[model samples]
Target: MKVLVYWAAVVVALALVAAAGGGQVAMAAVRCSPAELSSCASAITTASPPSRLCCRKLREQKPCLCNYLKNPTLGKFVNTPNARKVAAACRTPFPKC
Candidate 1:
């Protein structure tokens, strides 16, 4: 019983670490201003990949993805594959929004 409990605790801890490192929480830090969004929108729409400014905004808005994901309307934009591509181009990992 003791061994089983200890293993369960370890498993839970590891799972938490993996989830956090997967960028779900880190994405909360990555948002853009309206001006920044305007500029970023073109690139995002064109699928040209994100620029440095876009990447900065992405990191800034990172924290918001989970919330955005929870919203049906906003989730479409936040959860797109293009967004993930932009993130990759920017060297920012795609958060599991």
Candidate 2:
């Protein structure tokens, strides 16, 4: 009986850990792929206001901004003044990383 109780407690603890970590996994599944921000390309390169679609994408991609900034190929584009403008226009807080 004691062994069974110990096993049950272990299982419950593992389940709790998995549940807590699942949210991070789900977040990680969505990447900061530059392709995802294609809608904002024009706004980023030009002085035109960002479109609704661009703002939506920017909001969705906010969590990945730091990762994008760290990427050599995407860093230049993501760290640009225009990109920052778009982020400001969209009301998405830019990641400092």
Candidate 3:
């Protein structure tokens, strides 16, 4: 009856929403690794403005910032004033972690 059809439509809509959400999650999967931040090292260490490539990499790697902060070796470099400046220029928010 009409109720059965309505329930089927609701299930289809829910499935579509779930599929779209899964695509977003997959897209957000860290495309850039922490090691790729090295492209910005000179700017980070010397207070120079970041290059276009550096900014692109920074944005791509934004999600990995917290992980970098947790790493002792990487944390020292990422937590520096120069690094913060570079990140700001790139419009990448420095994670609290």
Residue 77 lDDT, candidate 2, scale 0-100: 66
lDDT of 3 by residue, 28-59 (tens): 77643554565676677567799999999888
The candidate maximizing lDDT is 2
Which lDDT tens digits does candidate 1 get at residues 1-97?
Answer: 5645553554454345335543234333443222233334545556875677888877666565566566554456557777678878877776764
Off by over 4 Å in 3: 1-27
Candidate 2, residue 33: how far the Cα is off, in Å:
2.1
**All candidates: TM-score:** 0.56, 0.68, 0.66
Q: Clashing residue pairs in candidate 2, if any? A: none
C-alpha lDDT values of all predictions: 0.55, 0.68, 0.66
Ten residues in a row with the worst lDDT in model 3? 18-27
Order of all candidates by TM-score, from best down to worst? 2, 3, 1
- Candidate 2 residues 1-97, lDDT tens each? 5645553554454345334542123355664444557677677777579999999988877777776677564576689898889999999988886
Q: Which regions of candidate 1 deviate over 4 angstroms?
A: 1-36
Mark the regions of model 2 whose C-alpha exceeds 4 Å error after superposition: 1-29
Steric collisions counted per model: 13, 0, 0
Comparison by TM-score, 1 against 2, better one: 2
Q: For model 2, give the 10-residue run with minimal summed lDDT.
A: 17-26
